[model samples]
Target chain A: MPMTRLYVSVLLIAVLLGNNACTHYYYAPNTLQTPFLQEQHDARASLGMISGDEFNGYEVHAAYSPLKHAAVMVNHFQVSSGSGSNVSSSEDSGAGHLTEVALGGYYPVGKYTTFSLFAGWGAGSVSNNFDFDVKADLSFQRRFLQPTVAIRGKWARFGAALRFNQLRYVKGEVDVEVGEPDLTIIRNIERASPLFVPEAGLSCGFGYQAFWADFNLNFCNIRDRDDYHFAYSTVGLSFSCQLDYFWRER
Target chain B: MEKLRIALPLFGLLLLAAACNKKADFNYYYYEPADYALISQHLNLPEIPDDYRAQLPTHIANLGLAARPVEQDKAILGRVLFYDKSLSKDGTISCASCHKQELAFSDNAKVSTGVFNRAGDRNSIALGSVLNFSAYYGTDLFGPSGVPFFWDNRAGTATEQNLASMTNPKEMDMSHSDIVSAVQSKAYYAPLFKMAFGSEQINSERVSDAIAEFVNAIGSYKSKFDKEAEKAIGYNVYSNNEYKSFSGFTAQENAGKNLFLANCASCHSPTQSRPAKMKANNGLDIATTDAGVGGITGVSADQGTFKVPLLRNIEITAPYMHDGRFATLEEVVEHYNSGIQAHPNLSEELRAPGGGPLRLNLSENDKKALVAFLKTLTDTELIADTRFSNPFK
Candidate 1:
């Protein structure tokens, strides 16, 4: 217990120290969607509340299987946050949203385990305003490949996923009034992109029949951090509904 | 199998199509890359003129201090840093916020505002009010040999003074490490830093050095006083009997010049290139409240003594004195004319025969003429020089 407490303390200290007052985060990974389907004609839909140090958001996830080993997924996320008094910049508010679609195949390894590989594309926009003087509105596109493994029981489920993503800023509009450092940062990102980011996630849940509740944690890191500000961690709570035999019956 | 193979390639092509690379527009007018390019083009760092490399005085040269010519690249980088408000903690204040180019690099405010609208304690001094800063203080030196900085002479060198202003709670309110990180995080600074220092590695010392180079290059040698003095170079301008008045000057201006040479030149230097004194007590108050240099040394004898600034561009840099107590040149001249307080550490030059503050009793015309002569010190060219203007678009 003492060791656990010490580790927690160190992690908190690292987090607090790493996030200086001047740093502005531009991106955070969404919660991993793990639809533990066992056979053909299976489907699941879930809604999650996402939270992080700089943002609070919501996500919608839907997954379906039409053939024996084929699956398709779609996800949407929206997040908004405002500047606290501790923030050094005069940023008044910020918001961002992303929607993605993926097509992949899943295989049942045993009665309780499944392995899946997915290829996806996502696009999003982020906007930040500073006391009406400087407004940054940017749009970005992302292409990613994700692999996931999951375990399921009558009443419990566990899952893990790793996503490799290529992120590129597609378009942007920044107010001329945006002063140095911020303006320079925007120009740098535009010139030095597209960035490769890798994300990892873990989730655990309890279920009975068709309904389930899950807790998720995810993290992302930029491979080449050349003047980019991305949130490293996110935590989410999801409620899901599963319809395994409904499509088979029809 | 055929359908799946076609679908895979089709999906890949779809993703590739996302790379339209549409350029961003600012207010449907300006593009980011183009703006940066335009700014880069405008800042064609001009070479420093030879006249700016004036000879160091014998006393300063004897102390191993030499006039270092300003490098164009370093000065250009420093100019950007000077105007960049991002150096402040709140991104609202910069060195140029107080020291403006049009006002002879001085603030009109009695005490300038800093980050978060915090009020400063002392009036902002003009950068090259009387003499070029490098000629007077010797840039980059950080010890007792060089003249100190600030109204109180609290900082040792230009770098220390820059750092002090950056970190002051009422000023920029940023740490050295934070400033370095801020500079490093900015992409446009990469080229600037590389140009100035041969690499993009940024540090607080380098930042200060660049700003010092830019500031040291600010010279005000084209004033009317300088032109008039130049014509009197061969004549015995110092001796009243042999010296004929300046040919360029009107009768009234020459009268004012004569009064200034007799009274103010003891401390302010008749040549107008350098001040005769670094710091002195002008008896602004009988008992010192701000303490001035005495605050730093904890010495009572040094009480009320403040840094003596050059009088160049005095006509425009109003709200004068360390605390900005005087509002105009008339008020400033009045203070020295008849209102010098009897402070214990009053400057010897301002002492009367009875050991009190010397009152320069003069007629109304004499005061007006003195004011007129001070106006001759204004350098219109320096204030309008494009090399020192803001480079940002």
Candidate 2:
């Protein structure tokens, strides 16, 4: 774990990604251990990138395990991809980026192989959307040969995600006059969502990487979240590497 | 930033749990006393001047220990609650609107007027001697072992009495939450509530206690018959011309008394000096607007058993009996002498001896005497007693 390389890697995504690097799992109460299983903790982070002006954005995440195979995390995201180039490039303002606090949990399955299924659920409010919902993200990740100083840059990932958002409202049902009777009702609506949101894609990168990273270009279904039946798929790259100072060999 | 946000919400949860616990405490604190003493406390507790125990002694001994210890503040708060108009839907009428003190704690007229000027179905009973009717023989007249109050005897105790009349559609029609809010918001009610409940917040139980306290305080009896009984009744010699010149009297009032005793006293004993409390089918010529006490208890035996009222103010509070059909005292007495209607459950005491209708051989003179005695039972001190006057005034 080299300080110069980790800093350089972080800076590279922040500056070159054009307002698209995101941080995750900071606000959620990720379980640091599995109560019933051996108190083993698991955490993860991911980054991606791609070539020239096709699509843009980046995401970084972290998690804690407190129960068997489950983790909670808080996340930050900045996505610049859009379905239509006309709407994507012309009307593009930085308003779509969001910073949110959520309570999320996930399960890791299949311990024998390097391959594992990733599934997670969470609820939280995004600064951009006043409403909220139950959200889910699923992915498949695998590390080929264990990273030694020599075989460090070996990894592959495949994943799909489905998320729901909610919106709420309120009304008054009591009279406001004298101690006399009031007759009113308050109405509330919470988290508006488009059911069946889907994100399916994969990434393969090479590197016996220590201060190393990879890029993933995935496809997302906009119609999975709303009624207008919009489609938003992206091809982009992300890079992730171990941070210095916190890096140590046991 | 994530750490700060998470900690803040956890704090909010702790506060919410504490608030919920306080609310639950209130629910648990009420309704549980080691020994049941409140029932008796509420039954005989009074707030006025005394020397007037009347049948209360016998009634209390009969009441004998089936009560819980209601707090003292409960009584004071209850009196104010009983008088406050906020108990009505329109906030226009309180319990006092119908249980006016001058009318022996009863609302006069055939039916009481309620919220929105709606008239009730039957005559309201005098709350005065209501506690006295808490028991019958050895058991309560209301439940399997309780007593009854009101002309219809619908409610069991002063508590039920306070409640039924308050919620009757034509009466107060108050909701519990609304009534609590009303009582809590009044300027003087806060301290009153705190004094009674150790807290100013009003709930249904406290509200019931306050009203019950007021009812408990409003007892009746301190009349001539009562005073006459303390010593030797024959000792207190009568010298008034009304009784002295009894032979020369012409007003049928003199005849009404003798006629009343001979024909009406079988059930209405000389002790009460009123007609019997039996639900006798009076020989009336037409159908009644009310089925009398029978309407409440649903018993065929009670078909016409209107409570034998104390006959305290027969003149001022006119339109007598459960229904206001009789209009005047003359009509009520005349019904007994000749107008009993034919009903299967009519009282045997009402049956004229020797088999036919219990017709009184009252001439016009006798009818007048009976009316006279009925009027004599109307004690002047009671009608004008200032203690029972409108508390608001």
Candidate 3:
């Protein structure tokens, strides 16, 4: 790497290591349904809870399929974690939160046992408030495209996906009010070139009903620069209910 | 049924958000007025009896260098800050880590270690005798001779010197803002700061000033040499060549004292007011890697010159010299005896009649006498003084 890139990588790693709550490693799952030939319109809504070290979150998602081969989806998520304390009081605990909204679509490639491709764009903000009156805010926007393939058996469904993501924008601002004059530090964070992430999971249906629960695990690879890299796995469980309105028979 | 499905998740999310809405209830500026009185008691600061202050020897004052009076409250505050480990970035090192009272406020190690056990380049210098050090250099109580501190003498005053060490990346590894933030975050510092600076607001200047006052207040006059010199007539005189042999000294010690007066008194003056302000190369090495004071001044002629420290507690502050190469007083005396090199910047006092390095040509007996005489300068009372001990329990 060039000297500038090396310096940037060192600084990025230091920042990430210093404020661990800001380094997120999870993204929303895509394409919940297996490919099936149908002429009617269908929509599904899901709510999921995910928990991990330094992270706990809830997500609300809704998807509508206008045609059997195409669907559009929207997801909203809020996550929070404790960043520890620097002061004596229990009230002086440091904490951080992240909120994101994403819009995406998916295309199915087969019937019964099927394959599909999906893409999404997202925007989010992360903020951490520390003891001694220190605060940091980071805003980011990203785009991702992925290819997914799934097989719908009689009782269960299994699927895997690989995503390529590009972070288009990132900005950070830090405020420190401990000293007399107070200070505000701002920086424009450069986005990493691109990242590749792979995810796989299994979903089992309990009964023959529109409502079903599924467990999905996502493996995320995040590299902010040439030398800074972070990887983690996130597991989520969700219950969804689907509704269908027949327009024309297949 | 569809409404319930949408309402359940939203309600759960609302509950989760409510659970996460934790606001810390701490006031950074909270301090009780009563805490001010409790600081000295809790830290066990020694109360300076009026008699102790009055009885302090006037030998330093007799040298035309006025004493820098130390206030009780300011020195107490300084004592706390000096030992507080929070001053460092990692809270693992403090001013006391390298400067221990047992070793005359100097470390026994060849090189002192700082935060993360990182070894510094130069040996730690003793700060215990800085009270007389100021008088020797004819500086104010804060040691601002326009000359610097440390082996390199890079800082102008004691406070500036301390600030440099606190922020040095290899030492405390803290920024100026970091020091202030750490001190302000602690509950104990509020009362101390208010007492020292008339306000609870802590700053770098006040912090350094308090530490400088504390260090400058660490003087020792109860040495064997002081007691013996007090009886000798004209002992307090500052004449260039005036030498009064002490009647109280032993035969061997007096012999060593005479030898020191003839050979070493020019640079390492027996009196408090030393005439030499600039450092000398001392011919420690032919081509010195550590440029000493010359590195700070950027003068090639000043290369290898280092500020000679006062030898008030020479016995306890062993592993002597800037790099701590001499492990014993005997080795130190041997260095000046036959080990002086022909460096271009060697002090003229250490040169022979032919203009090369002077070989003292002392026998083993004379070398022993000089070592014994140097031990007489040790101030046993200063090392065990509770006033300079660590305030923290």
Candidate 4:
């Protein structure tokens, strides 16, 4: 019953935040990964649904502890307004894809507590189309360094994370025919290339033995935000599976 | 494990290659090289003079006229739109067809010929009448100057005014859809649109906005009168009072100017800034035949009242008045001197104390001097500036 309620709540938020028209978000904050690895060969994989102000989609994340006090992670995400839609056919629509890889380390401070840090790089493309032919298509790369704290119990776990990210617009073509504020927004994004974006995340999960339902919410902070038209926050829910066969015997 | 490691790095390289930068590239994805070369040879964006981007003219500044700042890209787009004949049905007319650059942006005819050689009802308004367009029509419909567009002030903003002209049966005779299609069909305009706006999307609002910006960027305040006025008041003094005659003017010109200041400066400002009056019935007829502003408002009091135009560039923009009844400045001056009619809605300024027309029955030389002074209001540079010239070969 509780799981059903959580799914319903996530669906409601996604619907409410979908299809923000005539806006081009330069960056969409992804949920910070805080895998709390405690031993070698411990692994966790998750698939989540994402709800953003201008984009709604899904993401997949996997983390593995290769060595004691050392771990690696990979994340992939795809977002769009609708399936098989472009600006030519729709009043407002867009699609985007990103994948990142990272390596980090963790220290178990207590029986139920762990602290970790991760650094990663990601590449992606984002596009927005409105007013029939006015569109912004951009290929971008993001670099991030994150710090996290986690608490674990037998069947439940919680984590907090802060990720400092810098997004660089690598290249792409933009055709815009809008005026004023919308035009100004595109110019500002171009002017602010290699933009510094910072985000905070809170994640929690409840589960049985090796499977869990995870929920996460992230918020990004940008200066002079009113001049920018983009999603600053994202909420996600995911199903996570864990494998610790190597750590179980140890 | 070795194959996986090789594939992972290769995949990363591929992703990075796919995301390679192409920032600010406006060329078409298919035939970009040929299109870029053609457009480059044909259309060179104007290098707007520093004088235009500099501080407003002293007289205009004194009135605190709210004019839009010159945006280089948008202005270029506007210039292209102003000259493109495709905006009209049958491709026979453009805004420039009537608002010619040579004649101070006013046609030589009594009334301009439009699409299919249709005669328009009113004279083509001179765009160079003020320091700039925003100074004349202002930024909005009910802006600081309260200036509306058209001879009758029927349209509000420059966008509305241009749209009305484009759609008018006797003018461009093109619908909004037709306008978009015409603009979209032109391959050359795509690059210009990308330069002005961030893309090649041709739509009516963007079209009108670009044209308005271009029109607003028109006008040069470097007239002889402007130079003398600045010298008289010095720079940034805000007031042209205390000085009665321009030092640069001849005795006859000064005499004519004094007469103008006393008789005509109220409606057409001496400083050439915002005028004190908007529309007035200068007793054009004993009865309102065309009705003018009254026709739009259905107001009896507004009968025969036409917009009071700035006298700047009056030397070239002849065939004057709303109906272009006066062919020359002499006729215009003579009408004011001896031909004001005793109409019911004749402006109070034109009313004699005896409740009839007032006439400044000046001598012929005085009339000649007045015309000479009016000629000083012309800005020679504006008529021939290449920045405003047609880009088409």
DockQ of each: 0.07, 0.01, 0.01, 0.07
Candidate 1 structure, TM-score to reference: 0.53
Can you tell me which runs of candidate 2 are displaced by over 4 Å?
A1-250, B1-75, B129-146, B197-201, B229-231, B234-258, B273-280, B283-289, B296-298, B354-356
RMSD of each: 17.9, 23.4, 22.3, 9.7
Most accurate candidate by DockQ: 1
Estimate the TM-score for candidate 4. Answer: 0.57
TM-score of chain B of each: 0.84, 0.68, 0.84, 0.86
Cα deviation at A46, candidate 2, in Å, is 86
Superior by TM-score: candidate 2 or candidate 4: 4
lDDT of 3 at A43: 69
Report the lDDT tens digits of candidate 2 across residue range B1-393: 445434443433332233211110100111112211332233222221122222433322332422333344565567667777878899889887877767666666688889999998876665553323322411233343444556665655666677777777799987777777776666556655765676767776678767775555454445433443333234312322233223333445445545554566666654452234534555443344456677876776666556565565565456776666777878887887677765555567767666556666567767777777666555556556543444443
Better of 2 and 3 by lDDT: 3
> Per-residue lDDT for A33-80 in model 3, tens only?
222212225666777665444455666666665544455556666655
Question: If you assessed candidate 1 against the hidden native complex, which CAPRI class would it receive?
Answer: incorrect
Backbone clash pairs for candidate 4 read A171-B21, A176-B198, A176-B199
Q: Give the residue spans of candidate 4 off by over 4 A.
A: A1-24, A53-55, A80-96, A108-112, A172-176, A244-250, B1-103, B106-256, B262-311, B314-372, B379-388
Docking class of 3: incorrect
Q: TM-score, chain A, per candidate?
A: 0.84, 0.41, 0.64, 0.87
Cα deviation of B248 in candidate 4 (Å)?
Answer: 11
Per-model TM-score versus the true fold: 0.53, 0.45, 0.53, 0.57
Instruction: Give residue B351's error in model 4 in angstroms.
Output: 16
lDDT score for residue B152 of model 3: 74
Candidate 1's C-alpha runs over 4 A off are: A1-250, B1-67, B139-145, B240-243
